[model samples]
Every structure is written in C-alpha cells, then in structure tokens.
Target: MHAEVGDTVVVHGRTVGTTDRRGTVVEARGSDGPYLVKFDDGHESLVFPGPDVSVEARA
Candidate 1:
C-alpha cells in the first residue's frame, strides 16, 4: 500500500471486462496516497488505490 516516486503501480481490474492499469509514481506521498501517477496512455491522475492495487519497487 506504499509507493515512492519512480515506482510502478498496478491497478488490477476489480471486475470482469475491466483491464488492468499500469502507471508510474510521479509524486509519492508514502502511505498517504491518492498518488500522482502518469499512465502509459499519456494521462495523469491522482489515484487513491485500494486493496486491488500493487506497488512495485523501483529497481
């Protein structure tokens, strides 16, 4: 549930027919998310991820 800048965030589809979303953490707020993410589609949004979200560490 925690993420940092440069890390990747995966938002799994919670329901059938919905595709997964992948984005990079543009601005991290530690555990206080509603993080700023830049998606692969060239859009940005503030997302407060839930249990369906996974934060992958930057390597």
Candidate 2:
C-alpha cells in the first residue's frame, strides 16, 4: 500500500479479457503513491491505490 516515486503500479486483472494497467509513480501523496498513469486510450489519470492494487518498486 506504500510506494515511493518512480515505482510501477500494476492493476491486476482477474479475468482474461481484462487488460492490466501500468503506470509510473510520478508523485508520492499521503501514504501511497498517487500515480500519473498513461493508458493506451490516450488518457492519463492520477490514482490512489486501494486494497486490491499491487505496487512494484522501480529498479
């Protein structure tokens, strides 16, 4: 639930047709990383992680 800047956030898909979303951790806000996500749909969003989301540190 806690992540730093430059981390990678992946929205795990439960179904096969459900595509996974990937975004870079642009800024850290509150206890989690409020990610600046760029999707293939040509849109971006600032998201705060919920309990179901998974976060990976940038190497």
Candidate 3:
C-alpha cells in the first residue's frame, strides 16, 4: 500500500460493533512502512495498517 502526506486514512474496527477510526496521513514512510497519522481526536500515531485500512488521496 502507498500513501502520501495529507491523504485520509480510514481504519476499520477489528471487532464487530466497533466504530471505525479516521485520520490524516502526516508522514509517509517511503514505499513500505508505517505511516504517521494524526487522528481527528488530536492524537498522533505511527500505524502499520492492514487490509482493513483504506487510503483516500487529497484532491
């Protein structure tokens, strides 16, 4: 997977009935690595996303 800074990242809940999380990519680690994201709740994390994650480019 590939993402650029400013892209939107949607992380699906790991369990049923849980709410999904959304964040903006603040830093991308080359072509293969975890991305640094800033969530809407004012938190930041380096996430190695799985198949449940989707990225939307900034238009």
Candidate 4:
C-alpha cells in the first residue's frame, strides 16, 4: 500500500485477542517504505508495512 505523511497506519494483530495498533505517518519514504510513524501511545518508530497493516487517510 502507498502511504503518505499524515496518513493513519493501523497495524492489526496477527492473533486473536490482541489489540490493533494505531499510528500516524510522520514521514513517508518513497516506494516500499520504511515509514516513520508516531503512534498514539506516544512513541515513534520506523515501520515497514506488511499484510497485517492497513493505511487510512487522515480525517
């Protein structure tokens, strides 16, 4: 998926009973990214999205 800055990234839990993680794309690298995301829980990290991740537009 193509993600831009200000987009919301949802990292779904792979297994049952696990909570999904929500974060915003603070920085988007071109192509298959190593995106910089700032999570709602107040931390920042670089994420490479996979099948388990979904991207949403900032609303």
Candidate 5:
C-alpha cells in the first residue's frame, strides 16, 4: 500500500463487535513500508497495515 501526508486511512475491525477506525497519515515512511498515523481519538501509531486497511486520498 502507498500513502502520503493528508491521506485518510481506514482500518477495518479485526473481529465482530469492534468498530472500524479512521486516521490521517501524518507521515509517510517509504515507497512501500509503514506510515505514521494520527487517529481520530488523538492517538498516533506507526502502522504497517495489512489488506484490511484502505487509504482515501485527500483530493
């Protein structure tokens, strides 16, 4: 996956009863690697997301 700053990342819940989460890509690590995301909850994480994640461009 590829993303840049200002992009929105959506992480689908891993199991039932869990809610999906959305975050903004605050930092792009490399051409194809991990990314730093600031979640809606005010938490930040360096995520190496899998197929369950989707990126929405910032237009």
Candidate 6:
C-alpha cells in the first residue's frame, strides 16, 4: 500500500448498504510515503494499521 500524495486509499467497510470510501494522501508525514490523508468529502484522518498504509503513486 505504498501511496503518494493524490493517490487514493480504499478500505473495506463493516456493514451492508455501505462500502469502503476512498481518500487521497494529502501530505507525507513519515519517512515512508504513507501519509496524512484527506477524503474528497473534506474529511481527514490518519490511515490505520500504519504498515498497512502504503504508497499508490502520484495522481
């Protein structure tokens, strides 16, 4: 999951009638590219499972 700024993030949701959402990495906060991300809906949060977060590439 090595992602870059502008790269989209996808995760599985927990319930039916709802799907995982996608967000873009807005800033690289760590040594690796996994970064602080912001969704299209204007929501922002840190990706979980630190190592699970990765760089997808530039948009």
lDDT of each: 0.89, 0.73, 0.89, 0.91, 0.90, 0.64
Question: Which ranges of candidate 4 are over 4 A from the true structure?
Answer: none
The TM-score obtained by model 4 is 0.90
Worst 10 residues of 6 by lDDT: 48-57
Best by TM-score: 5
Residue-level lDDT of model 1, residues 1-59, one tens digit each, is: 78888999998998999999999999976576979999989899998978888988999
Cα shift from native, residue 31, model 1 (Å): 3.5
- Candidate 4, which ten residues in sequence have the lowest lDDT sum? 26-35
> Over all chains combined, what TM-score does candidate 1 have?
0.87
Candidate 6 C-alpha lDDT tens digits along 1-59: 45556777765565787766677878767656446778768899887534333344553
Better of 2 and 5 by lDDT: 5
User: Which residue runs does candidate 5 get wrong by more than 4 Å?
Assistant: none
In candidate 4, what are the lDDT values of residues 1-59, reduced to their tens digit? 88889999999998999999999999988766789999999999999989999999877
Write model 2 residue lDDT over 8-54, tens digit each, in one string.
Answer: 77877777888887777667666755766654455678877786578
lDDT of 6: 0.64
Better of 3 and 5 by TM-score: 5
RMSD of each: 1.3, 2.4, 1.0, 1.0, 0.8, 3.1
Model 3 segments more than 4 A misplaced = none
The residue ranges of model 1 lying beyond 4 angstroms of the native Cα positions read none
- CA lDDT, candidate 4, residue 25: 95
Evaluation by lDDT, superior candidate among 2 and 6: 2
Checking candidate 4 for backbone clashes, the offending pairs are: none
TM-score versus the correct structure, for each prediction:
0.87, 0.70, 0.90, 0.90, 0.92, 0.62
Native RMSD of candidate 2 (Å): 2.4
